[model samples]
Target chain A: MKDKSIKMLKTIGLGFTEPLIRLFSGEEPAKNGKLFFKQALLPLLSIFLFIAIWYAGATALYNSEAEVRIEKARAEQGEEAALAMRKCIESGDVSCQPNTLPSPAQVYTAFKALWQDHLSISEKKADFKARVADTNSEREAQGLAPITYTGRPSFLDQIGTSLKTVAAGFLLAVFIAVPIGIVIGLSASLRTSFNWLIQIFKPVSPVVWLLLVFMIVKTVITDPSIDKSFIISSISVGLCAMWATLINTSMGVSTVDKDYINVAKVLKLSIGQNIFKIVLPASLPLIFTGLRITVSVAWMVLIAIELLAQSPGLGSFVWEEFQNGANDSNAKIIVAMFVIGIIGFLLDRIMLSVQNMMSFNKGIA
Target chain B: MAILELNNVSKSFGAGSSRIDVLTDINLSVREGEFLAIVGFSGSGKTTLINLINGLIFPDAGEVLLKGEPIAGPGPDRGVIFQNYSLLPWLSVYSNVKLAVDQVFPKMSSSEKEAHVLSYIEMVNLTPAKDKKPSELSGGMRQRVSVARALAMNPEILLMDEPLSALDALTRGSLQEEIIKIWSRDRKTAILITNDVDEGILMADRIIPMTPGPKATLGPEFKVPFERPRDVTNINKDAQYKRLRNDILEYLIEVGATRRQVSDQKYILPDLKPTMPGRVIFGRKKKKDKVKYF
Candidate 1:
């Protein structure tokens, strides 16, 4: 039972827990202690060190920017004006404050503010929903459109939108690339002919893809009810990120062990069975590898695409915060940056775990 | 009547200057219920021969016939136990055998198919590990799964392409006996390709030695006079077994040496050195003045 749990943990990319589990099960304590220190505690220490460095850097930047502002005031005006500028800056006036980089404490405060904002928005949404419930019912009875909430999205809502968009874009990439990859992979001639096309399109910028999608979607999708930015951004992300999966799938398909093919032939399996049973299973490891790359690529390009499309996602949130120029705007932007990074890391881990599950060979993952 | 025949079958690979004959002018016939062993050195076109019979690859000249009908392509009628144990790694032992059983016996009921798969798994002593994937199985266990998969197809002619070569000696011997036992039940026409002369002598009704290639061909056939249920332990003491083994081995070594002699085309490389020989030392020689060396 314990072994099974260990295997499960290892499959989920949590092999660091193996030593902990062993120690708890009364295995060698000293050995497990060393392993735990190396695996878990060391990484925790590094994280703390990273925050310390960031805090130091942020403080240094703030001090230098403040000095520059005081110096500028002294040069432009008299000594009295410079003294007043220093006093204003010391009093935490938003107008004269150095807002170049936000400290770690400021970022935490910003995170708390966003959380509070989200809570307030949720309460407002609930109040609005309750107020409109009777009218919405009456409208539904009369076959008329219902009232809806049209307020600005909160930080959490923006994150939710980003997640939804990425999911849709990833699905689009899989749907577009996998079958095409299979077909191209099966035929050497097709692979050779399409190689130029793939090479040309694989490295296209997400902004260009968004513009291309925007051009087509604007003309084709005339419905105002549909979110045009969402569609445009997702399509762009899909187009920009699908190349990894496409290439990997084809390579995997083309390089399936010849012996397996021979077995399929001897069995007299039909084309469909040959592909699903023999070909797909054999190339699944490679396909999963491609998918993992696709997911990461999709995520990396999504922010740029979302920003260009004007979708209310983390990208838009970051851009808006940058332009807001509020006292805590830099801190909020830093928070968004960390959220994006942590989410990207989590997305990659999820892909890896899924890949490990699909693979029969434990060593493949 | 012969169940399977390779009539003047010749196969080659590549074209133009790169073209080389893998097998040429090969002919053989196996009667129903006969166990035939084609023994040869490694890379002696033995796999090519088995592939031709199984219809995995076509012969460049001549035809492979099954029951007087020329074989067009591979089918379940000729089941091949591949050299590398081509059991699908993603599939468990049961599922691997079930895949062939499902294809060959599609009309069979689900329960019947399950029974068939399980029976073969039992036959190869892999019933306990039936739920385990090929990656989890050892080399011998994997080969057993391969055997079970091929047998589950119930092919009229069984083709084995050095199936036991990858296994240890003990596993190989036990598998040989198990195969013979299985073959005797329905008396299937089995063709075993192997490099072991003793294996050929122990398992086959007729043993045929293939000479070494670029254009490898079959030599004279030697008949194994041993009876059914031949014991590997006691067979060593038999004078007949020793003579047959020696004869086949001697013939293989002789043909192999002669082929090597004829095919030898040594090239004389040009005697050349670097432009700055004193400065550039090659092949583990350190220069006196400089520290760097190749």
Candidate 2:
């Protein structure tokens, strides 16, 4: 059973815990302890070292900026004005606080602040929903639209919005790429003819895709009720990230074993059966590889697309925090940066797990 | 009456300057319930010949006739067991067999189809591995799955293209016997293409040698007069088996030697010797009587 669990852990790419698990099970404690230190404790120590470096850097920058502010005050006015400026800065006044790099403590405070803000917004939303329930029912009876909160989304809501947008874009990419990939893959002529088009479009920037999508979506979706930004953001994300899956799928399909095709021919299977039973299964490993890359690409480009489109997502939240330039704005931006990175990492892990599950060749995945 | 026939069939690849003939004038016929073995050197177009009869590729010149009817393309009537096992790696042994059974016997009820697939798997002694994928199976086990899949199709003629060549000797020996046992139960017109002369003689009713290629063709056929259930141990001791094995080996060797001599005369290689440097550098002393033959 222990061996099985170790195998399962290795399969999921979390083999680092093996030594710790072995150590806990009392199997060669001396050796396992050394391995556990190398694998686990060392990484934990490195993380602390990184945080220390960041904290020191932030403090140095803040002090330098504060010193420059005091010097400017003394140069412009008298010593009393410089003293007042120093006092204000020292008291952490919003007006005179340095807007440079924020320290770890400030980031932690900002995280707590964001959580509190989310809780307050949640309560207000619930209260609004309850208050509008009767009016919404009446409006439904009269065939009219109900009232909405029309309030600013909290940080967590932005993350939720980002997740939803990425999910939609990824689905769009799969829907557009896989069938086209298969069709192009089956015919060498089609693959050759379309090669130029894929090469040309694959490297186009996300911002350009967003503009292109916006131009089409603005004219096509002129309805006032529909959220054009969301549509434009998702479509741009899909277009920007779909190249990997398309190329991989086509290559995968074209490279299916000749023996499998021969077997299909001898079995006299129809075209549909030939593809589904033999071709698809043979190409699944490559297709999943493409999908894993597509998902990571989708997540990487989603922020830039969302920011440009002004969608209520993490990208827009980061932009808004940067533009706000309040006392804790830099800290909040740092928080958003970490959030985005952690989310991207989690998305990749999820894709890898799904790829492993779907693939037939366990070693390749 | 012949169950499968090749009439003046010819096949080639490429065109213009690179054109090369692979098989030429391949005329043969397999009578109903006869096991015919075609043995040849590797790359002598044995696979091309089998593919012609299976209708995988059309003959450039003549026609391949099955039951006096010309074949259109590959069909379930000629079940081909590929040289590479060709069991779908993603599918279990059961599914691999069921796929062929489903396509050939679409009208068979679900339960009937299940039983049919299982029976073929059982015939190949692979019932325990029915649920395992080809990737999980050993090379021999994978070939068994391939055999079961082909057999489940219930083809009128079984076309095996070096099916057991990838297996080890012991596995090949056992599978050869198993195939014979299965074939003898309800005799099927089968064609076995192989490079091993002994294998052909052991399994086939009539052994035919394919001469060495650029344009390989079949030689005279030798009839195997052994009775039902030929014992492998006793066959080695039999006088007839030795004569047949020797005759086939001698004919193959003679043809190979003549082909090599004819080709040898065509190419006159240039004879030039490389000249070595005069002295060996970085040495304590050069040998006084050293031969500089480069």
Candidate 3:
């Protein structure tokens, strides 16, 4: 049981706990504990210390900003205005905006508030959906087409939109890059031919690609009902992210162990079988590395594309909140930042698991 | 009739002034059920000759024939065991063998293919390691998997390119015996390429040495007169073993420097002072500037 736990920990990259598991499994505990302290405890302590410093810095900034606000109020309106300002700032009233860096407590509260906001907004959406259904049923009874709900999307809706766009974009990138990469990988001449294009376009920034894709999308897509920005942003993400996968896939394909290629040939495997069985499998680890990078690049570029396109996503949400510059806007932006980070981390973890499954080389993370 | 034949085969690499003649005028044939060994030093293009037979690379100037049909490309009929084992590291020993079995005997039932794979694995004494990947096995064990992969294909010919050369002496000895047992049982036409002279004499009916090269070619073939069920240890005491090995070694040494030297311009060579004649002693000089006043 302990051995299995050790393996699982190694697979998930919790190498610190492996020693602990070994210790529990009847190994010497002192040495294991020392190792655990080195690997796990030190890092944890460092993180806590970092947070402490952040908190201290926030407190100092808040005190200074609060003093500045009080001084401003006194200069503008006298002691009464200054007292009111102090009370509002000190009591943390909803009306006044604090000019200080957000404390850890404030960030935590902001996170909770955003989550609650999402839940309430989802409840409202459900209520609106039900009302639309009822009204649509009445309208149908009167021999008319059912009316659709035109409600504004909530913050949660925006998050979902971003995820969907990124997914579509990532998928598009994979579809475009993998096949082209395979063809290029299979043929030296083709690789040479595509090298010029890859080299030229790969270094081009996401913004330029986004504009190019946006222009094409605008002219080609005339459908009024569809959210064109989703397609635009997604295509832009794909355009920006595809270079990583393409470069990696081609490299992986080119460098697949020559011995495997010989074995395939000696087996007299057909071209398709040779490619699918030998080429793809042998190059899978590197290809997956590329894909993981591609997904990350896609996610990073998505915010910019969505913001520029005014697409319904977390990118637009953050942009909108920044423009609002209300008392809660800074906290909300911080909320979106953490959300984006967590999502990116989760995506990478997902890719790593898939990579682990496909790769034959083990015992190295 | 010859099961495998190479006629006036020549091959080279690179182009223009950088062109290197790797093999030249290689002519040989393997009769049905015959075992032939080509022995040579490294860079002698012995591998290039074997690859030509296996149809992995085409000869620039001549034809390769399998059963009187011209060889076009690599085929299932020619199974090659490379010097480095060439077993797919990603696959288990069983799957590595099964891949060949599946491709060569496509009409065989799944159970039959499984049995075939297992039998060859058994032949190589690797049945215990059947489920293990090549990386999990030791060097000798990995070579056994390569042998099994080639054997499972049941090709008309087995082409080994120094298959046992990578293993240690003890492992190489055991594997050599196993290879002979498999060869004798099936009696398929086989070609073994190696630098080991004793290995050639012990395992093959005929031994041929390749001249050292920029353009390497085969020396005269030497026939082995050893009886069946030859033991490697016992063969050392035999007069015939000594004669054949000495004769091949002598020929290889004689012609080792006969091939035309490759020009230094072909390579990006480091700057070094040209040695003055009679200034450098040739043998076992630890560093440069050794001179003998004989």
Sort order, TM-score high to low = 1, 2, 3
Candidate 3 has an lDDT of 0.86
TM-score of chain B of each: 0.92, 0.91, 0.87
Name the lDDT value of residue B48 in candidate 2.
92
The models' CA-based lDDT, in order, is 0.90, 0.90, 0.86
Better of 2 and 3 by lDDT: 2
Candidate 2 colliding pairs: none
Off by over 4 Å in 2: A1-13, A27-35, A70-94, A363-365, B264-294
lDDT of 1 by residue, A30-96 (tens): 9998999889999999999999999999989998999998999999997898999999999988788
Taking chain A by itself, what TM-score does each prediction score?
Answer: 0.97, 0.95, 0.88
Q: What is candidate 3's lDDT per residue for B1-294, written digit by digit as tens?
A: 788788998999899989989998989888999899999999888888888888888889988888889998998888889988877767788888888888988999999888888888999998888998776788888888888888877888999999988789999999999999998997998999999998999899999888887788888999998888888778998887788778888898778744444334456679999977786677755777868773
Tens-digit lDDT string for candidate 3 (A292-362): 89999999999888888898999999999889987777778878888899899888878877777778867
Which candidate, 2 or 3, has the higher DockQ?
A: 2
Kindly report the interface RMSD of candidate 3, rounded to 1 decimal: 2.5
lDDT of 3 at B182: 91
Best by DockQ: 1
lDDT of candidate 3 at residue A107, scale 0 to 100:
78
